[model samples]
Target: MSTWTSRAALAGAALALSACTEQETGAAAPREVVVARGAVLVAAPPGYCVDRTALRDAEEGSFALLASCASLDPNADGPSAQPAILTVTVSGRDPETTPPRAEALAAAAPEAVLATRQRGALALVHLGDGGDAVLPGGDPRHWRGATGTGGRVVALALYAPRESPLAGAAGGDLMAALAARIEARAPATVAAAPPQARSGDGLRATLARLFN
Candidate 1:
């Protein structure tokens, strides 16, 4: 859908797994599910939300979908007690959409994990990190995880308040659920095969080839 820029590259690198940044903006546009022709389905958990307008503003030409947990008090002070965020982005495998630097990225990140949607032949590559990892310019207090499959990458960042801590398994389960939902809803014609869940070397090579 759009060319991958440094931000996208960082996000792509996140597919391998940071920061906590408070959103200063007001509530986002009404939350709604987006179903793209490429058989991409993007939605958030019930009670959770996505700022479609803000997300679009963040990256105009990109196919990234960002979802956040609904907040009851937009004016609350300090770190939010909001639920985690889920971001799903798809990079078409065509030469124009896929970038050439993916190979080097894969080489450097050797700890990617492979996952799967519950109902399809697609395999997902995931990289997860707690608040300890540093995101390019994001909040280091938030937990982040990302998965890629069928030329698509889905990242979920769980943002809890300092008072509430989220478990790693929770993030994993959420990612899996989203993957399953995507596979179930994708169109039959969008049959792009996913990468195999192998070691980092193989996975990296596969991703480099698939994206580049």
Candidate 2:
């Protein structure tokens, strides 16, 4: 009707639009953590080998990749006689309610020893019985642990004994690199899936594929 009234209405519409934009920006952005070719994320430790494709394929639920590193005895004068082991675990969103998954994982891999439990967010388990330690003069060990979140959890444990120096390092390094890649790619909000009977098999297969 009146030019002044028209101007006022336009101004009000602009203000409303601005408010809506602000609201949209304030909401947390959804992020996908899986590493793709040419995707720049965090760098892995020096000399560490990585298999990005295999890691992404193994990803289950919301759990994403994280940092991984291999512990080798730097003091050994000769070729390392023990294999280095790397363990990775993913937890669901609700740690308190994730026990069933953990139990399933424990059941699937009876050799994995229970290492420790931290509230609902995390649990630690060893994969191999104490036999050959990775660290020189240390106990032979291969272990892994997991924590819970709201979504899902995944844990990966790897070992490379000293006898097979190159293979061991390669395996350990690949796992560690994959962990790093996962951490860099996945979002923190993504929780690990509950442990299922196929969880171990899937994890082992994923690792084998990565190395193979």
Best by TM-score: 1
Instruction: Write out the backbone clash pairs for model 1.
Output: 16-127, 19-138, 19-139, 19-140, 20-139, 20-140
For residues 1-212, what per-residue lDDT tens digits would candidate 1 score against the true structure?
A: 12112244345334322211343366433334543344455555445444443343211123333333434225433333235445554433322122223233323333342322221332333333333232343323433333444444433334332333332345545555555555323545445433333343333433333232
RMSD of each: 9.5, 22.0
Error of 2 at 79 (Å): 19
- Expressed as tens digits, the lDDT of each residue in 1-212 for candidate 2 is 01111122223223322332332322321122332221223233343322221133333322122211121212213222222323233332222233233444444453544343332433334444432432333234444434322333434444444444323234433543443444423443232323334533443343222212
RMSD in Å for model 2: 22.0
Model 2 per-residue lDDT at 174: 50
TM-score of candidate 2 versus the correct structure, residues matched by position: 0.34
Query: How much lDDT does candidate 2 score?
Result: 0.32
